[model samples]
Target: MTMRSRLTTNRLFLSPFTLDDVDELHAILADPRTNTIGSGPFTAIAQTEKWIRNRMAAERDHGLRWYAVRQKATDVLIGNCGLFRGRADAEIGYLIHRPWQGRGFASEAVAAVLDECRSAGIGPVWAIIRPHNTFSIRIAERAGLRLARIESDERGPLHYFVTSRANT
Candidate 1:
């Protein structure tokens, strides 16, 4: 929430995180599908708010950029999507609300974010995809990212992607 987002798209808009968005954030991150790759869920909405606030504080403390993804038509937030801990290269991460999944929203917003980053001179946007997350892997490939590695973690193997700014 330190800086405003300059990115927007036809179906979605990306803006800096706001503490007021706790409810919507909870709606998305608490879903089973969303949590499939996250830390866990918050039984209390207040806890989600705490987490969001903590993320903002952490971003400020660590000098990172975070953005909130919202539906343009409804002005309803779908989830958080951003280049985590920014650099000339960044890690692309997104999670769609369960009801909104499988509708290309993730691909659309992610593509939009990628284009935004490239235009801002952030080259070679990167993402670490969970090995079993075929959906995200396909989405990244469709957006022109090339798999760079199959990494091992405590969970298991995961794929890493890096997009070419020249092709963007």
Candidate 2:
């Protein structure tokens, strides 16, 4: 199924990423608080550029793309949310800038994406979150993904959350 390029919520908007987003996206990704659970913060603009290019290619080749999350009123980018092909099912993930955290933006964006997933007939979506990221874990649970197991990879332990058949 073809996913829409834009999604909206009461206070936020989600659109596909473009190279033009590099500067703002780089700032967000470079923030230590935002990258605490993942690889360390990005150190260069080229990294962010490459990131956008890769996601754009993924959208073209795999039908999976990351959305640039922005505030509707201000039209300022604050984070991102998207789905990725996973080992068993599509996986969902999101990140909100520290300045925008605790304001429910991440949760809102995730819920909107989950609704999109449902409409697209993508079921049993997974959320692979670092065990220490309690904030993300809470968002995953609130989005109706229950913990199925904990798995480890090169990145260490990760909590695997999946949408229930009934929920999806």
lDDT accuracy of residue 16 in candidate 1: 72
lDDT of 2 by residue, 1-168 (tens): 667889999999999999999999999999997866556799999999998888888778777767999999999999999887665647887989999999999999999998888887777789988888898999999989999998889868988899999878
Candidate no. 2 TM-score: 0.94
Report the Cα lDDT for residue 157, model 2.
92
**lDDT tens digits, residue span 12-90, model 1:** 8888777888877888777766767757766788878886876677567753456787888998888777766532345
Flag regions of model 1 displaced more than 4 Å.
1-4, 57-64, 86-89, 165-168
Q: Sum up the clashes in candidate 2.
A: 0
Residue pairs in clash, model 1: none
**Per-model TM values vs. the true structure:** 0.84, 0.94
Give the number of the best model, judged by TM-score.
2
Candidate 2 local accuracy as lDDT?
0.88
